[model samples]
Target chain A: MTDESRPGVGPVSLATVAAQAGVSIATVSRIVNGETRRASAETVERVRQAIKAVGYHPNQLGRALRNRESRLVAMLAANLDNPVMATIAASTEAALRQAGYVMILCDTHDRPDLQDDYLNAMRSQVVQGYVMVASQPSPGLRDFVERGAPMVFVSRRSPFGECSFVGPDNIAAGSAAADYLLDRSIEEPAVVYPSRESSTTRERVKGFCDRVIARGIPADRIRRADGPGISHLEIGYAAAQHFSAPHAWPRGAMCISDQVAYGVHRLARESGVQIPHDCEIVGIDGSPLNAWLAPWLTSVEIPHPEFGPSIVELLVSLWGGEPPREHLMPHRLAAALER
Target chain B: MTDESRPGVGPVSLATVAAQAGVSIATVSRIVNGETRRASAETVERVRQAIKAVGYHPNQLGRALRNRESRLVAMLAANLDNPVMATIAASTEAALRQAGYVMILCDTHDRPDLQDDYLNAMRSQVVQGYVMVASQPSPGLRDFVERGAPMVFVSRRSPFGECSFVGPDNIAAGSAAADYLLDRSIEEPAVVYPSRESSTTRERVKGFCDRVIARGIPADRIRRADGPGISHLEIGYAAAQHFSAPHAWPRGAMCISDQVAYGVHRLARESGVQIPHDCEIVGIDGSPLNAWLAPWLTSVEIPHPEFGPSIVELLVSLWGGEPPREHLMPHRLAAALER
Candidate 1:
């Protein structure tokens, strides 16, 4: 079969069109690359017709190689199932598009192996930079950083501590959650977190514990509920099992994430425990859907919409050879937590 | 500044490494491309050291151009905020990664302009195939199809036809929803949909109306709530505004999506309308989170996990020159609707 008729055969090349147009390959390349000023109108028209006749699809790979640039950036995210991650990705995609860069999003699902695979693949694709959301440290990532690749962390900080980061102040969020519960006269509040492996979780837990202790609540009075950290919702649900009875539950609690709060709420409803009336709960990462879906849940709202712009700005700054910087976005109490 | 020290000056090419190693550029290329058998062990080691010393980063673009394959596929989706879309994307990415192809996910947010932009960008990137999730067709998409590119439609069919589709049978889902309400001895059920423009919505509406009409319910008796169709949640919430009073709401309703159902549920709770007791609601796209988050809202569960494998299988088939075929996955009533 002819090249054009073959299914997986490569498209007609610039050489084929150049041969058909009876012009030099360089001339064809110039016209195809939009450098029409160097070619005569007649020659350009002839080359264009030859391109159509031969069905030549200008290979972007070739063009990018020639220009020594690929306007592609990869966003390696831990999870997309989390609405917060999805929101961040959506907004980041828009911001990147506006800046004339196409984003390639890869979901690592918080697996180190998958993260490495994506990192290696991205390298092969020559992605200009990376935006890692809740990234886990891996040898591949470290290698890329060592190579001086531009990258920015979002919603988490790099363990290596040399990359730019854009996220909410987790310690403050934890402190605020503590203060909110304490102000409500709930003296013995608990903090439920998936795992301390995450920088955000560790900082939040630290802040919560420190604040509760400083407020004259004995350290032992501040209960701690921990889970395997695989799934936030499952973590909260499993943690709540320890306090199966309504009276066994603390007067107030702080969940590391909104999803964890949902889990707690689910278990509480099943166990006949009323929210706020029995156990006031606060969560972080106030999802955009809270206003419509969970208006009653009081939580520290991370500005997810602003994350896209902040991440893109940091990436640009990194690309411009600026020293690594950290941007702490402001957070606020959303819904019932505002009071 | 030397290329190694200059940021974004392009990586040190194979030529540089070859020159430093005192070998032909072709030899260096073969060795770097993993053709180690063709080079002497000593030469290979020398080349490797030269590569490191010169800070050479292999450009995949040039390699891809030579191979006439990118090992990349682009998923152009309508919206990522929708949990269903995010689920599909995550699963598809895993499947594609397993098949040795990296997915580039682009969220168009249901805008025609953005769709066109992503399409154009993907073409320039030379994506091998496309997985369109509820895609809005545009001139660029038409051009790609006209060029005989491989593509598969997910959760929606291509408007132009001739493309493989993988999704739940929406008509059956709608009929099931209607049957579910009718079995409860509830008559005068209303169908709430964001827009009939979507193939899924159109089919669901048809099935619901047909089933209702066939059951002796007059066409006029079945109230239809419509919204501008921008946001599914807002659509359902706005549609619920017509039935502001608890008594005004129909005894049963079928929401086009789970998200829309959430909107209706939100409004119903605000209006003091008890679910199932005052109004029973059924939705489509039973999100994975429903078991944990929305067990009470009945929904037709689309097999989102299966979607990834099915879409990848179809893409492979299309690549192998097989004729386009439709694969309608099985859907079942989830949660309370099962009975």
Candidate 2:
């Protein structure tokens, strides 16, 4: 097949176009790069002809180097193993691609030093914009902005005033969980999650608390548990054990995540507690896996697929020199298993 | 504090170290780079003094440039949203880090072009090795290996030779699922998953089939379905509807993944099918989330945390000039809800 029509491998580069046209590299570059003001019509036409003949594709990185606008967006994430973050990454990539931007991914693993390294690397690479999902931002991030680079936060809002943030409306998600439990006629519900220190967990808890207060549920009716980490099963087992202990258990529960809820469900089943009938449960971050349980879990759908658009919008705004802002997408309250 | 000790800042680069030492950049670089075969002990001592004074932490990229070994492993996954693949990524990163290697991640979104782009980028960046959990090597990957880059495949074996692979013994996992169902005294059990194109899926099916054949269960007794893609809920809903149909469904089933098993559980509950007593379900990929679901899924636990170390070992072996081979780690069959 001709190189022009090759499936995976593309055409030759701009240098080949210059060679084919018997012209200076500068002339060919100027013509192809649309610096028509500097190029003669005949020269431009010759360069175009050469480009067509050699099937030349301009180097995106080289072009970006000259313009200082790479049309490349960098996304820094703490963990891709989290389905929520992965969905956000996928969505953001699609949205950015649609806007004629390429994406480069970096994983910080929640380490401050690594985040600093990535910020500098993104700067040196001259990516047009950045999206950071990790909660902690290193000093280098501030330095990068001071040195002139635009960035947006997703899933984590930066304390600094210069960066925009996009994520789910955690408070609404939490409140919705409370509403679902209350509507199910359950009186008191415990809350379980990995850490209350995180913005997501805090917001979720705040909403749940506000709703519980609004309903005039006694303060002593609520319980809270800090899960070990993302290992949801352990959290569930522990929480279940705590809840099933004689009269200490709350009548209902809201897990900070679906994974944790699964753990609770397992522990409850093992403990011989009936679900929904004895104690109702709700989870956040509606995962696809939750549906496979014998009793369908009631959950708050975080709109993971749409997270990309929200992140891309923030990045575009930053690229255009807009002030930092925050955006929270709506939540979805899923139905629970029918008795 | 010295900039090196700056909290939330990154490690000081070689440039800073050279500047702090007040020596020629080359001299400091030579010393730090262990080019000491020719350098005098005094010169090395001076460089070391400067490094200590500045608290110089070497840039990993620069170190790689000098040594021709990045010690930065790259993992290219098909879909980060898939919980199974996410576990693999997490496990692999943890393993590589323990071995003093940082990990770079890429999600190819199951596209050949995207896969090729990531492979090419990883190769150009001079990543120390590759751990791929995706199917089908892109042209860039094949070309890269032809030019000599160490690689290890996880989950999927490549058509090309000269690469190491590490994954579950699918035959064993599948057979175990079948044997477990039979152990429960179920006459017939159905197998469920989303796609047939996956190599892992094929292996799982083969293993399950082999066991069933040995048990004298007719081939037609194994019913298969597209469990769910990114939506296990849909799979659960579908399984529920299928099994709840007027005609009787199988008394037991084996799901391809934990996510799928989750759906089967839901289906059974919605259909008023009692697990183990009326129907039983089992799945692969021991995601911690399985613990919270009612009836607690019976699953095969692939060693997720050790996955990374195993892959790194394979890469190191290849780097040491080992020939193409396949390695399987032992796994556990855990009964979270039922024995």
Candidate 3:
């Protein structure tokens, strides 16, 4: 009755351990899988010894086949080159690890086809869950979720479908920036917003511009320029150059991210436009590193330490049913002038 | 005979397509698996239509089971928050993807136990290869390599075992920094070296200190302080405070990384010290962002753009057998002194 006589069970399996320990297959399996409460003390020890004697590496894949789901979680990132993305990713990965799952990091490089391919691959792997910083949600993504995949969208909610999302309240973040500029009584305020339109980006821009116009500041007074989704620093620098050419440099500027603000600072120095004395600048995404590395980032900052972990928690909560509601992480505007 | 009559094959498997099309299994497989040129056009078109009608999802898992390997590549990282590490990962992941493998990122957070657990889990999963920036090599790492896992170390060679390494020549980078400081006639030079001892860091410190001693200057004149391996910027800020308390502030500081240099600059500004006029700083890891964000960083820098991709290339060349030797990429001192 030994599995050694079976054609394909192989020499290193639960049957082999059971045969060696002179126990039932059920007893050996329970011991190997850490369900040892039912077995006798002597039996547990015997099976443990047998496992080592046979050099048995527990077959997680075969176990996963029975569960019909891999303990692997796949993350689709728009791009990995961005440090902010890293900040988000680091947070998500740490949280997932704590919950007993491994993450497969896939960078779609913002291409629809590549994103589709990874989604297709995920099905083949039977991964337990999906999380993403999606770029232009396609039918492939919707299809994955529709098939009842445990998925959560981070940074921006999917425009194509209603689902769980965990990110900063961009509208509020944007409005806060406008309020800061207005309270300082600055004239000729401007912005460097990314050309890419996510619900997240669009909300930030609308909040800022709408608040400015609401306060009787004409829309024309708010000079605006486009930056790409990634590499906002260089784009911010170029935006500065473009803004400088049209007229007198604005006395104050609001940037969508810290990199854009840094870019503006660098270009202004090159052009001999003194900060604060000539023109003051403020930015969003108040990264902790900005405090030490780019003090010039003096505006709305997302709470990364709290934001990242929350995304993972939200995903886990949805395991049994729907997420309670969309989670909104907090943001801060550090208005204290560079000390 | 129809695959419907087959005992075990699923409805959407390759066998189903073959049976429905009245063709041999090999002909259906070649066309379905992208071996289109080997099959006749009539056969290819018939198979393609059958695939659509049946909604066949390719069974990569079954193929992997037969081959006794997974197409997944596992990367063990020390820290992902640091942008320099991101550069290495981006390069490695991109190259691996182009070669038809997906990367599973595992950050050990510089813990030996976590490293060992990940190594153990890797064996359970049958990951085809391993690449790492090992914090401190242990028996777990040794066992994996001894068992013939395809592994390539980046940043520095294994601290415990012989292996293929692809990273900067830290000693050369260090010596070059020393030359820059001395040539500038820095009166009271200092260094902010990482407290962690990797072969890379050890060589850099040794090179810098050795070169200083070789010169007419005494070793004591070279002010020395410690910074963390990652988070060099904040640590640099702290190190600046540590260095400032002991006698006069050094005029030039050699930082272990560019982030450290930026930290020093921030601290100096707070202390009312002028850069270049008061304290000139040079750093290693010449990140491209340093050119714009930290023009103040002047010293030998890692060719990340070159170094990252090279690590991947080296790992690939060693796939069939051991790499003939480790790779040492080039570095340069950017002394342009910002515009």
Across all models, the iRMS values in order are 3.4, 7.9, 8.1
Which runs of model 1 end up more than 4 angstroms from their true locations?
A1-12, A15-24, A41-58, A337-339, B1-12, B16-23, B33-38, B44-58, B337-339
Q: Per-residue lDDT for A218-245 in model 2, tens only? A: 8777787665654455766675666646
Q: For candidate 3 chain A, which ten residues in a row score worst on lDDT?
A: A2-11
Best by lDDT: 1
| lDDT of each candidate versus the true structure | 0.84, 0.70, 0.74
Which is the better candidate, 2 or 3, if ranked by lDDT?
Answer: 3
lDDT of 1 by residue, B13-131 (tens): 77888989999999999998899998999999999999877767676666666776778899999999888999999889989989989999999888878888887677667677899
lDDT of 3 by residue, A265-293 (tens): 78887887877567777788876667665
Kindly list the per-residue Cα lDDT of model 3 for residues B1-339, writing each as its tens digit.
343221112224678788778799998888877888888888888888887665566755555555665677788888888788788887788878777887778878777788887776665665667778745577777655554456778886876567778788888888898889888898557988667666766888888888888887898888898865456777788778876643367878788778778888787878877676667788888876776667766868787756556666666666666553588888988873562
State the displacement of the C-alpha of residue A332, model 3, in Å, after optimal TM-score superposition. Answer: 1.6
* Residue A249 accuracy (lDDT) in model 2: 57
